[model samples]
Target: MLLPLVWMISASLMPLSEVIKVPPVWFAPDKYSLANYMEVWSRVGFSRYFFNSAFVAVTITILQLLTSAMAGFAFARYDFPGRNVIFLIILATMMIPFQVIMIPLFIMMARLKLVNTIWGLIVPSMVTAFGVFLMRQFMMGVPRPLLEAARIDGASEPYIFARIMLPLCKPALAALGIFAFLGSWDNFLWPLIIINSQKLWTLPIAMSRFTEQYIAQTHLQMAGASIMFVPILVVFLA
Candidate 1:
């Protein structure tokens, strides 16, 4: 598992010749260079892709956390009618693959005038069913007596949620945020389908195109993969 990652970073630093040699040039201390990374960054306008990805990922993470935390609190505490059925419906949607609904989602985005725009990549991804489910499960573990005591003291529902519930949900919120950020950052197929303009491409889409445009350039491909992997690795480690 780690070997592939190690090899990718190593090959990314090597020249084209060293990367493609028989048995592979596992290490090339003397020949390592940043030429491939430089070319990838400048030649392909990857800076734009990086910014678009970061913006979309951060926005989605914030929105997902807010929505999930709210929905989870409601599901865990409230006694609204048909709550179980509604929660079931939301969970059921998760079972259906995105591929099954991509066409309809695309048409809806087109109608909303969001296609080929940054929001096209963002709006559809604002809420994730998995996030809601994960948060709901975590919130269920929270004590009911504490919430009741807050209400008995005349604490408003909003205050109790924002001030009390959220403060206690730090671990769940962190996990959900990481999941949302990674999903948004690494997304490719939906962006490829919606973003027609070159300026709207994300890292995954740009990397796909880069692979095709530089098919024979193994060193460049490794360099691009390393660039893409670093963020997820850091977030995962942290």
Candidate 2:
């Protein structure tokens, strides 16, 4: 696992000759250079792709958090007809692969003219089954008496949700946020299928094109791989 990363970073720092050497030489940064990174960053407008991916990923994470939190809270706290069945149906979506629905989803996006747009990337991600399930489990652990006490004190559901539940849900929210953000950041297939313009391309799209355009250029490819890895690492650390 660490070996590939070790090789990538090592290769990113190496010259072309060392990058593709047989048997894969490993050494300290004795003669490493930042030239490959600088070259890649400057050549293909990577900054634009970086921002596109960032915007889409962050938007999806925030929207998913809000929708999941509210829906899960309602499911856990409210009493209603067929609530269990409805929740079960939502969870059932997790069993279905995106591949199964891709064409229909694409047709819907095409009709809405969301194809080739950032919102195209964001809309489908706004809420997810696992997210709802995660939040519900966390919200379930929250004491019901506490909510009832707040109700007795004249607090509304919205107030209780915002002030009491949200604060208590921080750890779970953090966990879900990280997963959601990372998933969006690394998403490739839908973006490739939807985006037609180069200007609208995300990091993964740009990276794929970069690989095709610069085939077998190992050092530059490693640098590109490093570029893709940085934001995820930063988000995880934060």
Candidate 3:
């Protein structure tokens, strides 16, 4: 695995012709150049694609954190009628493949006039049942006595959630945020269907096009792939 990854990075810095030689060239001729990187950036408007990916991923992460934390808090700490049934329904939704609902979701987005926009990508992903489930599991480990003490001090539900639960779940929040961001950042199929404009293309879509347009230029394609991996690598390292 490390060998393949290292070779890919090395290849990305090599000249285009050397990449597909009879035997692969592991390194550039003399010194590595940023020519492939610059070419990909210019040809694909990669900066715009990067911005689009960042916007979608960040928006999804924030919204999922807020909404899932609240929903998780309610499920973990509060009791009401049909609470189990409601949670079961939400969990069931997680089991249903997005592919199963894609058509209906597309129609809903079209009716809302969100198709071809960032909202189309961000809105549907904001509420994730898995996020709620993960957060609720984490929140369950939190001491109820602390919440009771907060309530005794006249702290409301929202205040307790804001002041108490959130701070305690930092690790889990980080884990969930990383998961959500990666999911949104790498999503390609839904974006391809919903987004009609080149300006709205995310990294995955842009990379796909890059490969297709530069099929003979393996070095350039590898550079584009390397750029896509940078954010994910950073998140994992963090």
- The CA lDDT of each predicted structure is 0.92, 0.93, 0.90
Q: So what's the TM-score on candidate 3? A: 0.96
> In model 2, where is the ten-residue run with the lowest total lDDT?
19-28
State model 2's lDDT: 0.93
- Could you give the candidate ranking by lDDT, starting with the highest? 2, 1, 3
C-alpha root-mean-square deviation, each candidate:
1.1, 1.3, 1.2
Best candidate according to lDDT: 2
Model 2 residue pairs with clashes: none
lDDT of 2 at 205: 95
What is the per-residue lDDT of model 2 for residues 116-171, given as tens digits with 9 covering 90 to 100?
99899999889999999999989999999999999999999899999999999999
Q: Is candidate 1 or candidate 2 better by TM-score?
A: 1
| lDDT at position 39, candidate 2 | 88
lDDT of 3 by residue, 1-238 (tens): 6887887788888886777787867776584788888977786689889989988999999999999999999999999999999999999998898899999999999999999999999999988999999999999999999999999999988899998999999998999999998999889999999999999899999888878887888888888888888898998899
CA error at residue 5 for candidate 3, angstroms? 1.6
Clashes of 2: 0
Per residue, candidate 1 scores C-alpha lDDT tens digits across 138-162 of 9899999999999999999999999
Clashes (N, CA, C under 3 Å) per candidate: 0, 0, 0
Off by over 4 Å in 3: none
